[model samples]
Target: MAEYDMQELTLPNEDGKRILYPRMQLYGQKDLEYIADKVSYATSFTRGDIKGLVQAITEEIAHSMSEGYSVKIEGLGVFTPSLGLRKDKERESGEEGAPRRNAASICLRDINFRVDKELLYETAGHCTLQRAQYKKCRRSSQMFAPEERLERAKEFMKKNTFMSVAEYCRLTGLLKTTAANELKAWAAQPDSGINYRGRGTHKLYVLRPANA
Candidate 1:
């Protein structure tokens, strides 16, 4: 009974045929409330009771995973905690051939989940699909020329006093690395009217104050 935004994408395989795929839209806590109500009506429990149970389960799952435990819900999935790789870290106080690292060296970066195969298959069978009204699009940012992108960035900096790399990408639609290189290049070109400031995460692009 639920509708999803579906869009047709061309496969780059040998057949190269277009196929409709569901575009997943994000659902929030409000959607969870609706689900709790429906579940309450189906069973004897009240909506508040269902909501409380769901919250308790979520909290418990998080607690277990934090303790380096993998939890599996009967009809759903398994959630496992994992750490991120710190490849760029220099060897700080290590032996001649060995690198010294500890638990503090890396943080718990992700909690991953694997769906239950049976539940996945059954759920997929019940879904209704519909096509999106919008046309399919490739990355339109890729269409922009370097000069055009610089002009767009200049236009953006006209109002804002400073901008982060993330902010620049959001405004100009350029990817992060692309935006960084462009901003640095402009900064190196003396008297380019655009100046880069600050270091690392505190970086910004600023307009020249006209004489000095």
Candidate 2:
């Protein structure tokens, strides 16, 4: 069984006609573990055994492909290495009338996959789909006013020594650039109540002391 949501989508090119469709939300590792458990219960193999089997198969597939060999699983598909030739423009360097510094090169572009359509269709023979029980998003657009955002960060720093841009994004739902700029702006002011340390991903924001 799988769950989906009926979503209303409008494309910029479309004349603003709302299109309704079911959007599939995928399950992660939990689904795979559950399947392994069920299969183990119905067969002699244990769940651990089933997991190891899957891991072994996956490793072999990857190993074969890395060795420049094509792999084909009966119920899945074929995995083939696809090559791409880079056409880097030639530019004379070093001196006038000198030879071009670089030339075209070939590299592995991607792994090509051709699915087994018959096996996929057979696997979906008894499939079931249902609408998801929607829950409100934890955060949204205009989640907080500008002053309130700064206040929120100040309050957070009271409980914690520092706040990273990633932490602020998670707490305030602001994009990385927006959070970074806000933190930088607060830290730039001489008497502002916020300060940051380090640079880029290593940066952390802390509250400026009241006495300072």
lDDT of 1 by residue, 71-183 (tens): 99977999999886566655456668687777667778788999999889888899765543323233435656777767766777887777666555655556566678888
Candidate 1's TM-score reads 0.49
What does candidate 2 score on TM?
0.45
RMSD of 2: 13.7
TM-score of each: 0.49, 0.45
Off by over 4 Å in 2: 8-16, 82-112, 133-212
lDDT of 1 at 142: 61
Please report the candidate that would top TM-score against the real structure: 1
Per-residue error at 157 for model 2, in Å?
Answer: 39
Error of 1 at 41 (Å): 2.0
